[model samples]
Target: MDTYSFLRQLADSWALLALTLFFLGTIVWAFRPGSRDVHNDVADIPFRNETVPVDDADTPDTGAKS
Candidate 1:
């Protein structure tokens, strides 16, 4: 019944359960209903800058000309 033994037992039991519940809760929250639009917007972030067409010929060529 010493401090170290008590802490070890509590951590091995309640702490483990708490962490597992927190992980499952996070998974549930991420896939919850009515969040598809928000998720889609976030997923499109990388392509946001690509919406405007880029013409390479019109841009300057910074390469050294031999």
Candidate 2:
């Protein structure tokens, strides 16, 4: 009922374990190894190749200019 009893009860409750777990999880996550260039050396398969021509009309004549 008093302040001292409340403090003592809180110190022994599951709140202490929860707080410890939270802090431990935070430290582990903060110092965990991170990825380096995760997409590096990765290849993508594009459905369409832009380098190929779709129509012959767009090409210029290879004959003489005259």
Best by lDDT: 1
Superposed by TM-score, candidate 1 places the C-alpha of residue 4 at a distance from the truth, in angstroms, of 1.4
lDDT of 1 by residue, 1-66 (tens): 999999999999999999999999999999999989999999999988786666799889999999
Model 2 C-alpha lDDT per residue in residues 1-66, reported as the tens digit of each score: 999989889888877988999999988775667622333323333533548757888889899977
* Best TM-score among the predictions, by candidate number: 1
Candidate 2 whole-model C-alpha lDDT, 0 to 1: 0.72
Alpha carbon lDDT at 16, candidate 2:
93
lDDT of 1 at 53: 60
